[model samples]
Target chain A: MQYQSQAVAKLYFTAAIGLFAGQILFGLILGLQYVVGDFLFPEIPFNVARMVHTNLLIVWILFGFMGAAYYLVPEEAERELHSPGLAVLMFWVFLVAGALTILGYLLVPYSGLAKMTGNDLLPTMGREFLEQPTITKIGIVIVALAFLYNIGMTILSGRKTVVNLVLLIGLAGLAVLFLFAFYNPDNLVEDKLYWWWVVHLWVEGVWELILGSILAFVLIKTTGVDREVIEKWLYVIIAMTLITGIIGTGHHYYWIGTPEYWQWWGSVFSALEPIPFFMMTVFAFNMVNRRRRNHLNKVAVLWALGTAVMAFLGAGVWGFLHTLSPVNYYTHGSQITAAHGHMAFYGAYAMIVLTIISYAMPMMRGRKAANSNRSQVLEMWSFWLMTVSMVFITLFLTGAGILQVYLQRYSDTPLPFMVVQEKIALFYWMREVAGVVFLAGLVLYIASFFVGSKDPEAAVEQAASPTA
Target chain B: MTRGGSLPETSRYPPGDLAVWIFILAELAVFAIFFAAYAFTRMQHVALFDQYQATLDRNAALFNTLALVTASYFVVRAVTAIREGRTASARNRLWAAVGMGGLFLLVKGMEYAHHLGEGIRLSTNAFYMFYLSLTFFHFMHVILGILVLMVLAMRTAAGHYSAQSHTDIESGASYWHMVDLVWLILFPLVYVMH
Candidate 1:
């Protein structure tokens, strides 16, 4: 169990570092575009870059979940993985598929891929890869299947612990939800209906399951919290998630020509969606406070704590502020949406993924513990840098959205899209600056992974075992 | 195995079950929102909703609901039967419950096919959209519940579950009851309210 966990840990660390780098690179591109229009236009447009950025964020997070699953399931079940060979095979297949998918995005001509994929986003003459969503969808499914099989078989054989059961249901949800990608409905409404099935359900629904499982894994490890205590938290978190999330999708439905009542339904439920995130924050901190020991892997704990705080701010508070029908009536589909997306994903899932990587790295390397005071300090800085920048970005974008909605959406003498676009130029520039700060944070995080310390005192504190 | 010899030994109904219940309850809440949406939307298109409701096979939904309710009852009976060492009775009741759940799904699939033949789809209209999403979602849960029952039945057959080791049965039953509870709401909203 220990050996396999370490192996999975190594895979996770590599993926995390790569993902953090990707995040910063794309963030910089996005940031610069806000300031310098045409910075990479015709060569690497915003649309294509955004696809890679968002999709990579999703992919790498999934990779982290797999790693966490591989590590925890065995330990929780008190057994080895059902098939380590299958696990290894699934990992490489997913990696190769992921690499090819991204490469295919870059290398394939936009027009050709768009034509082949039937994406009607643009003429695709000079566009990057936003037009080529087919390959990406296929890649997602393959990864989902490989992951489902690996984890599914393990749970099928192993003891059905709360951790494993929740993880299994969550993974199963991942698979069922991905089925939406295969079909291409012609009607835009139908198309979006299924899209929400994949998008909203996966993130707000199953992803909550994933978060619960990961949090459970961390609590059991770091605090030696009774499995019972940790497991109960997982349940309550998931319960809160579903209670709000199902209706939360209504937020997206507001402008999608769904019923008018959705405006009310989406707002009310989405306002409640933050409750779980709030609960998650309380759960993480309460467990930490109730800890029997004072040992700290500062980086891992930093990421975990950051997950709670950022999720509250991004998914909870930000989501609620705009989720109301009255407020969203103005802000829907604006850059404000982009701001929320950036912060929420980074805050909730991204940090959780990073936490797993940081937690598992030393264990994977067979280091008794990682003693990287310098890296931990750097990581701590990165968390704040990225978080603070995102808040700035969200603030500016929200301001931009309010202006856009008031002047453009509602006014009789409505400005043209380009006119409003030009008017919001300052906010855009501010976003770009904030993006740079975020990217700098990522740079620090990636560097910290490889160039950290392993001294004994820090190691002992990290692992809570002097011998380790 | 005593840690510091101070804490009591681990109890049977551990935190896992509570956690599972919490999760299950939250899931029910999401479905509640979904059901509420269906009701709210249905109210808006009351004429069309009424027309559509009249078209539905209430008999089918009612039967499905009754079957589910009965199955949930049998699950309780099975739990009691197991407790009293009535293994054969428990097994029979469990199999019957599983069969009824399957029957509900079969009837639902047929009804869905009928609706498809009548040109209803997820986005056919507001009425059909809610109908498909709500019932289909419920159907998926039924399928899941049936799978759980199958596993419990296998375990029961193998004598792997005893009164003390019956958390699996209880959890499965709780989930089945939830499925039934959702049907209780869905039946009136989808088929009977008009």
Candidate 2:
């Protein structure tokens, strides 16, 4: 690594991958519970498994973003980190708090865990995705502040580049919006209203800034393109992102007992939400096509390109499928939301993290640019295995969603939720099988790291002509 | 400064940065989908749409249209002036374009105030929802377009651009025209069309 502080990213990335494996494992458990309802029984129920699954995904992705920022910020700013010591300290703090939270979820009843963690004093528990205890949540805020202080100070003191600036903005927004997680009023409607300020605003809003800046950094490094060209596009893309995404928050307001006008406003604006993803897809391919040299990190390039296409398909196309208020009337809170959530999260956040790790890991490990060919080949295999399995998982869920909607919502004589779920058990079975394949892919992905560590770095074909 | 000879062959492509063009295409796609949605919804509630369509201030809308079209014309003249090595004229034309944008926003703001005073909001009715949503959305674009024009004008007046290297001017103009173009479609689709 060019900077000593950049090496700290290795610890965070390794933790991220480990937690990702945990996420997939819990995901498989949740999938099984969907079919064999009593498989885990009282020992580990569906809700606990789900909390573990989702919480792990969130934690791991946070780790990935933090790791990515730690790695790229120094390079972009043309200086060493301001405080590597602070970064390492925060890493341990976040990991321990996250682990304790997960263990509490698994080892104790959620209510018991809540009581133990002083939920009565400040109850932020029992909420979707904000299920962490009050203390853990406070710890998270503290850790985030320290982390930001270190990274923000480094960026401000060093050469200011668009990549670093945009990343800082995104990270700052993430921390700020997360404060809403603490403001849970007893009014259910108002609670749901601001809940989206944290969830929706994070993914659809500022997190996109983080995603775009990282993608730009990787493309600039690998494509040998002019930084000015990439940076210009970065500005325009993020401008469109906020312009559309801020108002796109209306989509979640519908049917939440807020106001009826949100139907039209949400439908109109959220439908436009896919535009930025489409632009992101075109941007990734356009830059790669216009590459000045073929970098040796072929797998990183694959990941960067795959991130673009999959994010478009998963987040853009699937998102647009039910973003309209009329369509959402039938599909809201159904398996379709689950289907979209799985793929969109995987494609946009998960894949982007993996993309950055794939790009940075080799350099951190003392390789010139890339992994050995055998390792890369295995990694590519894992990519297709995980990606294709995810597509099938989404498709199976979509099938289940459509059938559920037909039976439960749209029929002249609608069936109850349980009755329809039992009827749609076959699709759930298919989803479980796909989930297994996804786990296998994760196993192979982990194996890729150890498989060819002894071999020499992958050689580049210098004579191969670059083609768009 | 030298002119024309240093410029790349841009005949086969759109003016300004390729990045801005991509952004323009994305914006157009969004507007296209929104318009299609509006048309489909209008078909479903033709009576309601027609009723609300009558309440709109067509005079103000017409005035705003003239302002945007004139602003676009001025933007074109500014680009032309810059191409002929006339920074002074380009700056003037750019400021004139900004002034036209200001006029559009002012007229549009008055229309919004009228609606608000009449107790109309996005929650009022389906027709009002679409009307306010479309017009207000276009209004924000006008403000953003004006910002771009002002930046370009200031930079031009400060002699930061020349005939040989004025991609920023071209890019800013391209975005302004897109804002104007969307309004042209929006004006008839929402205001004039029954």
Candidate 3:
């Protein structure tokens, strides 16, 4: 009944390291491109590198989710997985498909790729990274299906528990949302319209379910909080998510020419989206405060607690800053949106994934206690780096977004397109530097997973300590 | 961790049903918000919404409403039958509930199809948006309810529920009742009152 799996954990750990390496390399390339324009424009073009960087963030977090599902499902059900082979198969297929998709991005020039795939050529919008093609889009569907099958089979055959059921519903929602990829809206405005289905719904919708289930799992393990307490929290979180998030899709539709009511609809609902995250913060800390028995994964618990607070700030407070139609009118595509995106991803998804990994890796290795001083130090370092760098990134982007919006959107200044572009270029460089610092934290994280603590006595002492 | 204070089973109910009740309560909160939105949006454009409301056949909605109410009645009877040790009769009542629930959806779908043929679509206006969103969301829950009933029916056929282990029946009935309650609200808000 242990909530850990060695095989699945290893797959995710490996994916995380590879993805982080990609992140760091692309992070550097992206940063340099802004400072010295036309520098290395041919090899690892800005568009390709940026796509790889953003997508890698998404891929690694998914890797984390897969690992968590495998670890938690069997334990919650009190049975072994229906098929470990299927789980392993899903890992390899997704990894290989992910690699090929990235390789495809690198091999074809943006225009050439569009031409080869039969898209009409136009001036690049400079968001080279967001050009998701049909094949890669299909690849995501396949990955989601494989995960659904594995998790579905595991749940159907095992005991039905509230925690496991809630978690599976969340995962199922992820699969359903991924289906949005198949819909290729012909018009640009309509494309961005349905774009919210995948982006907004997944993160704001199903992702809420994921966060709730993960938090419930951690609390049950670490605090021995009553099953009733944890299950109720799970239900409330998902309910809030659905209530706020479904209509909250309106926020994205404000500029997409859908309807004007979304301005008010989205404003009200999204303003309330932070309530669950704030509740999550209280849930984690409150459970810890009332722990019946101490557990070994304190750092993991710390990350879980941290994810809630940061997610509320990043996705909630910061998102609200530009969510309303009035504010969003100015800040729509500015660096301010970029700022919200970075903190929200790291705060909500990144930390939750890390929490699952931290909690499970030792259990997977059959370690009886938390890791020693070195691993803890590395983890603490990881936390600080991601936290500090993200804050700075948000700061620079907010300033940049405000400036860009004022000059480009509002002002009738005489700055030419090229000149204005040059004026607002420094913020991109700042973002690149922040991304690098975040990458360093990621590298330390992957290294710690492999060469973890070897000091058993120290680990035991920490585990025995009440705070753990 | 085995406590001496655990509740004794009151006839056919088990403690796990408590968890199911708790889950139902949370679902009600979510549905409440959607209902509130439906009401608020209706208020925003009362004339358009009322015009759209008239487009819906009141007789059909009244029938659907009656069907759901009857399903709830049958489900409650099923629970009672199971508690009284009439397993076969209980299964019949549960099946009757399922059939009624299925019938309600079929009638609702036909109504939607009729309306759609008249050129009423999701993006037609705010009224249609709420009409489609609220109805479709409710339809999804109806599907879920049917699935729950199917599970309970299968279990009952396998002799899983009895006078002493019919918590499943209670939970299933509780959910069906909720579905009924939601429709009651929907009947007035979206159909008659508007």
In terms of lDDT, which candidate is strongest? 2
Docking class of 3: incorrect
Q: Residue-wise lDDT of candidate 1 within A174-288, one digit each (tens)?
A: 7888776555566777767667877888888888888878876876777667877787677778766875787678888888777655665576578778878877888888888
Q: TM per model?
A: 0.71, 0.95, 0.73
lDDT of 3 by residue, A159-252 (tens): 8878788778888888787665555566877877766787788899987788789878877887888887777667766766787788888888
**Residues A365-432, model 2: lDDT tens digits:** 99989899899889999999999999999999999999999999999999999999999999999999
DockQ, candidate no. 3: 0.09
Q: Any residue pairs clashing in model 1, and if so which? A: A239-B26
lDDT-best of 1 and 2: 2
Best by TM-score: 2
Pairs of colliding residues, candidate 2? none
Let me know the TM-score candidate 1 reaches against the reference structure: 0.71
In model 1 chain A, the worst 10-residue window by lDDT is A122-131
Proportion of true contacts reproduced by candidate 1: 0.28
Task: Score candidate 3 by TM-score against the native.
Answer: 0.73
Stretches of model 2 off by over 4 angstroms after superposition: A462-468, B1-10, B36-55
How much is the lDDT of residue B47 in candidate 2?
A: 97
Give me candidate 2's TM-score against the actual structure: 0.95
Q: Compose the digit string of candidate 1's lDDT tens values, residues B25-128.
A: 65687678777777777777889989877889989988898899999999989888887767777778889999999999999999989999987766667887
Q: What is the per-residue lDDT of model 3 for residues B78-178, given as tens digits with 9 covering 90 to 100?
A: 88899998888888888898999999999999988997898877768887777677677678778778888888888888899889888767877887788
Chain B TM-score, candidate 1? Answer: 0.88
By DockQ, the best candidate is 2
In model 1, the runs with Cα more than 4 Å from the true position are A1-19, A38-215, A226-295, A312-332, A364-366, A372-378, A443-455, A459-468, B1-16, B56-65, B81-90, B99-103, B106-125, B128-132, B188-194
